[model samples]
Target: ENKPITLLELPTSIASNTILTLLKLITYNVIFAK
Candidate 1:
């Protein structure tokens, strides 16, 4: 799902990056939180 985002806006870019990070953390937790 790594589409090319037009991150010309700084806050938008930061928010998206933060969301991606959170998603990764959640996925990891789901797998390891057994």
Candidate 2:
């Protein structure tokens, strides 16, 4: 049967890359702002 959990499973790679990019951006912003 189709379920909501299936939706969460579909984007693992994309989510990780997006999260990593966001983290890097935040870190760089903090460093430059200092």
Candidate 3:
């Protein structure tokens, strides 16, 4: 059914979004750390 397609697509998109969020947080921290 749709399960296989969802399994293949959701992880990569979710991972990328999570990574981008983490990177943004890190960048902001660095900028404000001074």
Candidate 4:
């Protein structure tokens, strides 16, 4: 039997936002390191 997928099974928008924030932080660190 096939089951339906649910939103809870996937990463939400907040998770993506957090990832973007982390990337930005890393980019800033790299720029400042130079």
Rank the models by lDDT, top first: 3, 1, 2, 4
Expressed as tens digits, the lDDT of each residue in 1-34 for candidate 1 is: 9767575776798988999999999999999999
Better of 1 and 3 by lDDT: 3
- Number of backbone collisions per candidate: 0, 0, 0, 0
Model 3 worst lDDT window (10 residues): 1-10
Least accurate 10 contiguous residues by lDDT in model 4 = 2-11
TM-score-sorted candidate list, best first: 3, 1, 2, 4
List runs of model 2 lying over 4 Å from the truth: 1-10
> Which residue pairs of candidate 3 clash?
none
Q: What is the C-alpha lDDT of each candidate?
A: 0.89, 0.87, 0.90, 0.83
Candidate 2 residue lDDT tens string, 1-34 = 7566566676996798899999999999999998
Best of the two (1, 3) by TM-score: 3
Clashing pairs in 2: none
Across residues 1-34, which tens digit of lDDT does each residue of candidate 3 receive? 4556577788998999999999999999999998
lDDT of 3: 0.90
Stronger candidate by TM-score (1 vs 4): 1
Candidate 3 segments exceeding 4 Å error: 1-5
Error of 2 at 5 (Å): 18
Candidate 1 worst ten-residue window by lDDT:
2-11
Cα error of candidate 2 at position 8, Å:
7.8
Taking all chains together, the TM-score of candidate 1 against the true structure is 0.73
